[model samples]
Target: MPDRAPQPVDRQLPTDEARDLISLVRDIAQREIAPKAAEEEDAGRFPREVFTLLSESGLLGLPYDSEYGGGDQPYEVYLQVLEELAAARLTVGLGVSVHSLACHALANYGTKEQQAEHLPDMLGGGLLGAYCLSEPASGSDAASLRTKAVRGDGGSWALTGTKAWITHGGIADFCTVLARTGGEGARGITAFLVPGDAEGLSAAAPEKKMGMKGSPTAQVHFDGVRISDDRRIGEEGQGFAIALSALDSGRLGIAACAVGVAQAALDEAVAYATGREQFGRPIADFQGLRFMLADMATRIEAGRALYLTAARLRDAQRPFARQAAMAKLFCTDTAMQVTIDAVQVLGGYGYTADFPVERYMREAKVLQIVEGTNQIQRMVIARHLAGPESR
Candidate 1:
């Protein structure tokens, strides 16, 4: 049967404008994103045109300033839009998040001239982006990244290093790269906006993964990639801080995406349970199955609420790093569980790719690892609660 009409989300939007924005997003997601999600994912094809469409429709830069071509939506509203897109397809939603993350350094920390020069196109100009911070040797310990950017003749910088597990690595139009510029450790890192077609910049083959194949994760190599001094973002040694600041917000994006996946899985399970026959009645009649659905729905709602709470705190200009970490941790773990249970509810069909639940399960696994591992998230939360670990 046709998939239940894009499971309704009774979002508690604060304004009619926000509600209307969400409605627009849902309409686009249901019509454009959801229909091709399964087919595109199976083909391992990144939908570049779809991203262009999102750019044209102005869904790409929702949480930034409208003067710079963003949608000027609040984080709560922006994240709800992300949830809708992710429910339709994880690649698209996560792609938007990474693009926004790439834009963050320039948007929040760039000089006024830099903003005037680059912000508009990056936001709504249909130029895809990638955030480059994780090195092959430093995934969880991001501060230990060793990609080096050295000063060169004539006020230029020469960057040479490899960035691993970068989403949209090969296809991005621009990358917000972080590289060591001073002495060792986090204090030495600096951010730069690197053009994708720079002479020495190239991406290795995409990683062969369990899921989300449509979204490329590859190693981007900067072999003496030339960047003008003007491309530098913030101070010479502020990249790590800028990267962490962006991630604090980016984690909420992941949380929203996780909730979206969980909600989709729950909807599929509910639909299957109600329709599938078990002996004399539908399987939804079984108490055990019913309770599973209840728990799934409850977790989905809780995750959504948690992310929104953090988003509101950010909108209010409050310190929300700890809350964002909690949402990321809780929501990703919930997605993993919910999708696995979704597979169980559908019996054999769920285990196979015949249904999308298996894909959802595989996709959920990466969410736990990306942005920051759930283990790292715990460390962040603990530090917030009881100060940093005593060196």
Candidate 2:
């Protein structure tokens, strides 16, 4: 059977404008993104044009400053948009999240001159971005990254490093990169806005993955890529703090995406159950399948609430890191379980390439591992609850 279009979720949006925004997103998702998702994903084709469309539609900069070509929406509204996009396609949702992350350092910490110079183009000028912090040796221990940026004549900086698992690596129009400028740890790092086509910058072939093949993940190599000091964001020693700030919000994005995937899977399962009959009645008529569907719906609802709570706190400019970590942890784990149960609900059909649940299952696995692993999220939460772990 053909996959059904996911039903529109009833959301508690903040305003009429937010409701209209969501309606528009659902229309776009159904019309533009969902139809080609399976085919393009199977072919490992990245939807660069879709991102272009998003930029043109002002969807790319929804949570940024209106003065600099952004939509100026709050995180509460912005994350719902993410959930809708993710329900259509994880690649698009996560790509937007990463692009927003790439823009965070400059948006929050750049001088007025810097913001006026670059923010407009970055926020809405059809330019896609990548965040560069993870290195070959540093994933969870981001502060220990070893990418080097050394000062040169004429106040230029030459960056040399390999950044691993960078989404949109080769295709990005710009990258927000963190590299060492002083000593060996977090305090030595600095952020720079590097043009993707810079002289010595290059990306390796994309990684082969279990799912979301439509999204490229590659290693970015900066072989003495030179940029003027004007490209620097924040103080020389403030990059780590900036990166952490971005992650707190980025975690909320992941949580929203997780809920979206789970919602999609549950929708698929329920649709299938209602349509597919067994023993002269629909399987959904059976108590066992009904219970599973109910549980899946419940979990998805809980995940959505958790992420939204975190987003609200962030929108209010309150301390939300602990809640963000908890949201990422709970929502992603829920996605993993919901997708698994969704597959079980579909029985043998779920295991096949013919269905999207199998793909969703694979995609959900990575959410637990990315942004920060769920294990790392637990460590973060523990530190918040008690004191920092003893050395």
lDDT of 1: 0.93
**206-245: candidate 2 lDDT, tens digit per residue:** 9999988999999999999999999999999889999999
Candidate 1 lDDT over residue span 259-358, tens digit each: 9999999999998999999898999999999999999999998999999999999999999999999999999999999999999999999988788999
Worst 10 residues of 2 by lDDT: 1-10
Candidate 2: the clashing residue pairs are none
Q: Where in model 2 is the C-alpha error above 4 Å?
A: 1-3
**TM-score of each predicted structure versus truth:** 0.98, 0.99
